[model samples]
Target chain A: MIQVEGLTKYYGALAAIRDLTFAIDRGEVIGFLGLNGAGKSTALRVLGCVLLPTSGRVTIDGFDVVRDPHEIRKRIGFLPDTPPLYTEMTVGAYLEFVARLRGVPSGRAKARTIEVEERTATRDVHDEVIGNLSHGFKQRIGIAQALVHNPKLLILDEPTSGLDPVQIVEMRQLIKGLKGEHTILLSSHILSEISQTCDRLLVIQGGEIVGQGSEQELATQMGSGGYLEIEIGGPSQGEGRAPVEKALQAVRAVAGVLSASVIREEAHVAQIKLDAPAALCPQVVRALVAADIDVMRVGRGSAQLESIFLKLTQTGGQPS
Target chain B: MSATFLIARRELGAYLRSMIGWVIIAGVLAVDGLLFNAFALGGGDKRSSEVLSLFFYFSSGTTMIASVLIAFRLLAEERQTGTINLLYSSPIRDGEIVLGKFLSALAFLAIVTLATGFMPMLVMIHGKVSYGHVAGGYFGLLLLGSATLAIGTFGSALTRSQVLAAILSACMVVAMLVAWLLGRITERPLSEVFSNLSLHGLHFQPFQAGIVHLRDVVYYLAVTYVALFAATRVLEARRWR
Candidate 1:
């Protein structure tokens, strides 16, 4: 539903975003991942038709952003990092106003407002003034306004930025529910917050797209292999270092095991790290058990994606 | 045009609901009444025509200042509060946003300006003043208010700070008000140019004297149109920045 080529934006002599190229298919939820000042907002603003790119072309649903921004505006709903809300207006009235502003006929504006309010779970506060609502409700109102007109695409910049943990979970579910009805593009600095909610991830750093793919695809591409974390207890007490050394050697001998090391040793228990695909984890565990190392726990490491993200961003996706 | 009216209606509703709008109306009316009692009606004996003219004269100052205050928040406050993104991302044109804001302020200013009609009616009650004179004076105030409000809209478009918008608008209005003074110092052709450019000195005198000139009407409208156009351009330029 969206395609961008060489999208560059410059404020005076400094470039905010440079040479950004990506395409988003219909019915897909894409997460734009970047740290603060990583040009994520600038890129999204350009795509939202709020700012014009200094160079490059962007088209949404076959309409050019620069030449046909009005057409694009009618088809896309955008919620900026700070929700564009009129504090004096009631939630219902504000949603109705936004509905009409985006070309929803006046006759149907109220119905559309109610529909969006229901979707965003803001129905109870329909009559409440926005300024009086809590931050979580205010964010929901922001999402409601974006979808009030039922646009083809939704551009949300950091939808969960200031929310508390419970609010964040609610927001995640709300966004997840929005999938299939509209193509969603949301940005976030926190990987775990958006990783599960999005179908694909676009990692950006220094105004450039360093990597793009699903979580596992990005992990496999950046990480030589998945990591395996294993915890084992020795048969006898105070045999700590000997059992850890024996388990590490046995795990390394297994085929497809790239490397192995003892992570930590305490009493008779030792934690070992193995650089091998998760599919070979069973074999590593078997080798450790056959070596008389009592297996307490065996599972895929959780830092696989985290390591990939840090590696891609720090190295700019260059070969290590 | 519907988009323009949609924005205008919302903005006007905002003005009606907020305390600042009512405060401006009350403050301007109080100041207008005080000036009428102290200056227009108080100073010794004078003809009814002179009194009405003086009323228009003082009311013009209040209208100009009130226009600046009313319009300073039109666009600047939207930017300050970050609500401008709603308008910016909508399908509406830049001209529509500018015109919608200007129209709302103009409507509010007209209501406040007309509310001071009792002062003119007081002159009509005691002495003999032509209805034409009242209408002419009011027409001039409206036109002057419209033009200054447009200038204020342009100023508001230039920055996100309402105080800065007010200052910028005051500077523009004062410059045009003092053009006649500038004309007095310069020679011949330059003086004529400056005199013709004056916002109030020459253009408003005919309306103040109970005579509506086509040229004066056109000049006020021309100023309104040009300022509104510049404000629209400023809004459009923001997208590029």
Candidate 2:
């Protein structure tokens, strides 16, 4: 549904986004992942038809952004990082206005508004003035406006920004529900949220795309073969460390194990980090049990998306 | 055109709903009334034509000032509050956005200007004032208001700060208003050009004196058109920025 090539935007001498090339297929939800100032908003704005790229080309649904912006605008609904809301208007009125603005017929605008409000779960606040709504409701109103005209693509800059945990979860569910109807490209600095929601992610840093793929693909690309973290209870006394060491060695010998290391050792338990394909986890666990190491707990490690994001952005760089 | 009217309707609705719009209307009307009573009516007995001319003179000043105040928020406030993205991302043309905003402010300013009609009617009651004079004076006021609002819309498009928009527009209007003085200092053909180009000097004097000149009407409309076109260009340029 979208294709961008060499999309560079410069605010004077500073380049906001440089050489950004990507394509999004129809019905796919793509997450733009970057830290603050990583040029995520600039890229999204270009794709949204809100800003023109300094150089390069963008097309949405076969229409050029620079040459056919009006056509593209009619097909795409963009929600900027800050929701473009008229606070003085009621939620229903605001949605209706947006619906018509995006080319929905006036006769159908109210019906479209109600449909979007229902989809975004903003039906109860239909008559409430937008200024009086809570932030969560306000964000929902933003989503409602975007969907009111039922465009082919939805570009949301940061849909979960500034929401509490519950609101974030609700928003995630809301976006997840929107998957099949429209092509969605949402940007966020929140790793877990993007991971949980998007089919694929574009990791950006310093105005450049550093990585792009599904979560497991990125993890494999980052050289960690999708790891397993295991916590085992074993003798940690003077001579007791020997059994734990033997268990670790035995687990390392499992068929798909690339490497293994003891993460930390406690008096009665030891946490081990294993570098291996996730499918080999069961074999590693069986090996540990056969060696008389008591397996306390086992799960996928934190080094999945987080480590890949950190590696791509580097540790100290802030998200743009 | 439908997009233009849709935006205009929403903007006019905003003006009607907001306290600032009412404040501007009340303030301009009160000031117009005070000037009419203290100066036009109270300076001593005079011919009704002179009184009506003085009323137009004072009302023109209020109209110009009020136009700046009304239009300063048209685009600048949208940019300030970030609501401009709705217009920018929509399928509407940039010219439509500028025209819609200018028309809404023009409509509001017209209402405020019309509210001061009682002052003219007062002159009509006590003395003899021609209906043509009243109509001519109001037509001039509307034209002057339209021109200034367009200039202010251009200024609003140039910045996100409403204060800066007001200042920029006021500066443009003041420069045009003072062109006649500039003409007075310069010599011959240049002086004629500057005086003729002055926004209120020769152009509005005919309307103030109860005569509607075609050239004056065309000049105001031209100014309105040029300013609105510039505002549209500025809106288009913002996408590049």
True contacts kept of each: 0.78, 0.83
Whole-model lDDT, model 1: 0.92
User: Which lDDT tens digits does candidate 1 get at residues A1-320?
Assistant: 89999999998888999999999999999999988999999999999999999999899999999999999999999999999999999999999999998999999999999998888889999999998999999989999998998989999999999999999999999999989999999999988887989999999999999999988778767756678889888436655378778888899899988898878877767788888878887788889789988999887953456777889889998745
Fnat score for model 1: 0.78
Candidate 1: list runs displaced more than 4 Å.
A230-256, A262-272, A281-298, A302-305
Per-residue lDDT, model 2, residue A104, is 95
DockQ of 1: 0.76
Clashing pairs for model 1 are: none
Q: Give the RMSD in angstroms, all C-alphas superposed, for model 2.
A: 3.1
Q: With candidate 1 superimposed using the best TM-score fit, by how many Å does residue A139's alpha carbon deviate from the native?
A: 1.3
All DockQ scores: 0.76, 0.81
Please identify model 2 stretches exceeding 4 Å from their true place.
A229-256, A262-272, A282-302, A315-320
Candidate 2 lDDT (Cα, 0 to 1) = 0.91
Query: Per-residue lDDT for A304 in model 2?
Result: 60
TM-score of 2: 0.93
Task: List per-candidate RMSD values in Å.
Answer: 2.8, 3.1
